[model samples]
Target: MKNLLLTFCLIISLTATAQRYSDQAYLQDRAEKFDLNEETQNIALLQIASDRNKAIKILSENGLLHPYEKKIRKDFEYRPLTDMHIVALSRYQEQFIYLTDKAVLSNAWAGKFYIDHGIQNPKGMAIGADFLTLVAGNSELRVFQNGQKIWNTSVNNLNPIALEYDKTTGHFLILTEDALYQLDLTLKTMEKVYDGSNLTAMCYYNDEIVLGTKDGIQSLNRKTFALNKSNQKLPWTEITSLKNIRGALWFGSTKGAFKLRSDGKYDYYASKRWLVDDHVVDLEKGPDDTVLVLTKEGMSKINFEPMTLAQKADYFQEIQRSRHIRYGFTTDLTLQTPGDLSTGYNHDTDNDGLWTSMYLAGELFRYAVTKSEDAKLNAYEAFEAMERLTSLPDLKGFPARSFERDGYEIGLHANGFSGEWYKKHVEENGRIWRLSDDEIWRWKSTTSSDESCGHFFVYALFAELAPDKAWRDRAIHQIKIEMDHIMDNNWYLVDWNGEPTAWGKWNPKYVNSFPTNVGDRRLNSTLILSFLQTAYHFTTDEKYKKAAEKLIRKYGYDENANRPATTIGFVEGEDLSDKWNHSDDEMYFLTMPGFVNYSFSEEQKTAHFNTVKSHWEVERSEKNPLWNYLFALSGSKNIDSEESAWWLREFPMDLIDWKVDNSHRKDLTKIEPNFRSQTYSEVLPGDERTLHLHNGAYRNNGGSDGNREYAPYIYLLPYWAGRYVDAISAPVPN
Candidate 1:
């Protein structure tokens, strides 16, 4: 009996040793699979050693490798949108489309559905098919039409990574990491359809299952499970997504994308330059066979027509110049004599005021590509002409006038001048005026002179780009003056100097009041926060930090006070009586908290983060796409939540209500045709009959007038938030 016990103990010890080695082998295999070098491997091992479960989890969560265990661990169940399984759907005739990112079901029609994952819920629009399908993690399969239960009896233990309905066979082909399965929808059963291959992407083509694997494309007979042996030259690598576009098989892979002809030939398309990045996460065929490619950075529209080297070079040059203009580096905003009119189409209007000319010049410059010098010259001349207008000085600052014709000045138009000047001056200063103009307008208010945040922003940009430190210093000084002029004793800012002026249009209670006399706390809080944020970026000044924090806390950051909700429309003063200007207030305020939180103390950051998160949740739930997009771009952690994804995919619905009225003037009513210039109020769903509102926001030259302007700049926000890139530089966790 003692000898028997010893033998048993030995057996147990051997089993334990084998298990340990197995786990270690699994970890090493995954590390290599995910391209983790020795250094990352060591770090991962250390992380695993500290908490074997958590370390294993982090690695697997980051797609390093599939966990060794059969069941997913509880702690690492939640996946980011990037890692989630994506189900792209288009209806035959329905306007609403459905996107199932992992377990989240987002409808383009009804907005976002806040259904929990792993739960059996029959949500979203139902197709007339017998079997309902959904994607969960790597698995895509047919479930019961009413619930989350899998329908295929033979599909047990099969880990499906992708699925497509084979209309020809009346079945669904499921692509797993290892193999593929064909499920008979009518029979409610599945069979091992294909073997001896590692499948990646699958689609139905001409009543057959067109399978894309590591080897190549293989077509299976619809009736019989036998593979077609005659033709199999479909070249694909790491096929990520496959779509049937105009009868051709459009397959997007990690290496690039490809189109397989019905005749069995293939054309390779590298997405590195053609698309956003090498990793084409998804692809869909848009109008005219144009491919909508989604990548890690963003989405891009790719025209399949191959261009010559010269054409490519010209296209890239145009793109580069457009990018510069979009970032507000330079633009033409002036009318020049004897215009060549080669680059942009010119139209002369009766109201050829300075503001109009400046706006026209900017519009032309924004659209100009080949004739860049002409556009630049025209813009420079317009700025010079505007500067020749008569001088009028006010206590707060000089009024930015609207009309400038042959060197004559006109008083500022209320709503148009302030915002337009701010946008043009700060965002695109080089095009507006020369860097030397800073000294000329050093103390001037009127006389086509620079004042306000618009001028300050322009000067700042010029100083940053210019060679001279003196020019930069002068710009900074001008910014200081503008900051002082707007900020009141209570830390709130007055919009403008004139009584009930355009500046005070959004701040009605403080209308027509000097900075000292103004008492209203309006959307200027957001504007002031933006100014301080910009100032901090330029000078790294502690004063800007203090001002930003003060304004944030006083307005909506605290959450305890009955402060105005950032999601609501802005009405001037303390009056909640009038309907809020939802577009202007919300868009500005939505991004402000995130900006402030990035630079604030830990406690303050937490408060602002929570406030922004809460507001985002509400905005997302309400299907406000513009706000949702901003919230997502703001790096809201809750974006990874199932609820946020559902909302974001549906919020574009509100944009459909936008309309444009050409009759409405900036002075009479806030009407801007450019979708980029619109605030939340302008885009909000309401009965305010105004021209120039687009049913859906229009994207011009890959950029919009409003929040879309900041899309390119968003990449810098994460770095500014103090998140170190390398693990060694990160703060040690408690």
Candidate 2:
């Protein structure tokens, strides 16, 4: 009867809300990496046409509609070495017709072309329904139908600079250096639409003729041809090209390409995330409603395919296993070259245990929600790796940060810390490595409080949720051993040198040393109390309970834990305590689940629940799915479910750390940088910004050139946790 009651309570706690939207097709946009092998200055124009048969075949063979479909369907066709100096290009019946300095020609068709006619020194060209038009030598307008000259007219003094076919008016629009003209093919006459200079590009949009100029966009009424100057600001003033794609006006400027949204905002695409170069030369529509932006070096095809959040989860799961796993722990991949996955090599990190715990906890929740055998297997594998961390150092219960094979540099610098600052810190704490009993490996030491927080959080879940009694017993044993070591060492993680490692101190004197506003004061107090509560809840150890009560009553740890996050502000002259520590946000939230679940009394649960709520209220603006979902799991009904779903859907399919820069964007409203380090007034969407696991999500910009790929645990943890809590739904068949 007692076991039945416990199981019932577990189910109620794990599933805390009603089910949300099921999986259905939604547009998920991702950038496909494509670049040319060598540089060329003679390239004239880029043209793309739909290749449905090729796209379908590639999709059918790989069962993945991505990577190959875009490559095969919308691949750019460019001249390798054109000494003819191609001046203009257009698509006619799925074939490219290009005009050069000497003559006009077809890529696949070899009929005697423009030069054979009277056309010479063509300035620009456009393809019509049954004919092709060009401003020949900027002196005359000529048309060709069925590979034969059809019509000719004079526009010599106009000095035509560009040409386009307006299907609505059945006329070829021509742009001169200082004027716009419409050439009626049927009437065989030319009429000037509007006189304008500095007009670089033009496109038909929303029943109006839109023009790109040196300053910004200008539009003209098609009927009256009255020009209206645009008040809209762009990412760059020098508009190079324009295209109307699916009702949205896309502007390609010297900086990047941006789509004008209906909300008067711009969806800016810049950096290596979207283009090979910021100088967008042309914009065109591609297969499957994709948008192609052409640069001097290469083209960027933004593919928007139908996908559910669940499908995205599966994709990331495969990525995690294939690229990130090292010795059963979710590890880092160091690349020899930027943006090149082929050069990536798996490496051990200092927080292997912490990172793996988060991933294992995610898998645990996944198994709870779906009963997936794969999730169970993944969780157990990560648990074994963490289990090794504790025992590898040969200390009673001290956990190593990470481990690598012998003969690798085992210094503080090799472990990612460097210079005199880290050198002094490591010297004060002793060496950072200890050899295993077998003497074949070296384990990194000086495990910090966040590592302990992660272990306590995940091990507590394992003790309660593991399928077999043996696994549950093992988890409980780990909790007991670690808690005993802390208590025995006078509330500090005593390292191999018999001293507390830096950042692992939790004694009253150490934690209370900082002022209350200093984040460390509140953070360390919450961590130790949570550890004790978790240990006591699982083991029913009176000593663990006594240690927690003593801290609460004598050291005021309960009060410290209850302090609102708003109280955590800068501490002058205290480098560690000053400003906001984004990493502590991870530690606090990760520890809160264990802390709230294993509270000794109802009063403690209520107090800690408010702490989680207070922290979440501050973080609500970021729309972070993980933080919001975890807070909802703690029994808050005001969770931002819609925002969470938006974040998950907007997260880019490509996880490569491409260099991203949003500082040049005019769409964003910058704020004076504050304590939280929020640079922008509004947070960018998940796909628009760079995301690192421990960094602030509100950061508008900053990334390296595809050198690193973060573990997918950042998404998996929040997604599975939300699912387990019934805040998110499983996919339903379309």
Clashes of each: 33, 2
Q: Per-residue lDDT tens digits of candidate 1, residues 154-250?
A: 2344555566655544566667766776667678676776674667666666656666665556677766757885233333345677777668777
Worst lDDT 10-window in candidate 2: 56-65
Q: Candidate 2 on 1-734: residue-level lDDT in tens?
A: 01322632454455444446465789888766455432222343343333333221111111111124223232233333133455555566655565665556654445444444455666667777755555456677777775677788876575665687877767888876678888887787888879877888888888788888888778898767898657446767788888888788999998888888889788778778778788887777767788877776556788888888888899999989999898899986778887777898887777899999999989988987888999999999999999998888877888889888876733543365778877886677655777788999888887888899999988987876678789978988888888888889999998888888778899999888888888888888988988998777777778888989999999999998899999988778888765678888888888877667667887888899888789889888888888876676566666777788888887777777777777776667889978888888887887778867844666667878788888888888888887876667778788
Worst 10 residues of 1 by lDDT: 23-32
Cα lDDT of model 1 overall? 0.37
Runs with alpha carbons beyond 4 Å of true place in candidate 2: 1-19, 38-86, 93-95, 100-117, 132-136, 144-159, 184-189, 409-416, 422-430
How does each model score on lDDT? 0.37, 0.75
Cα error, residue 348 of model 1, in Å, equals 12
Candidate 2 residue 516 C-alpha distance from true site, Å: 1.6
What is the lDDT for 599 in model 2?
Answer: 75
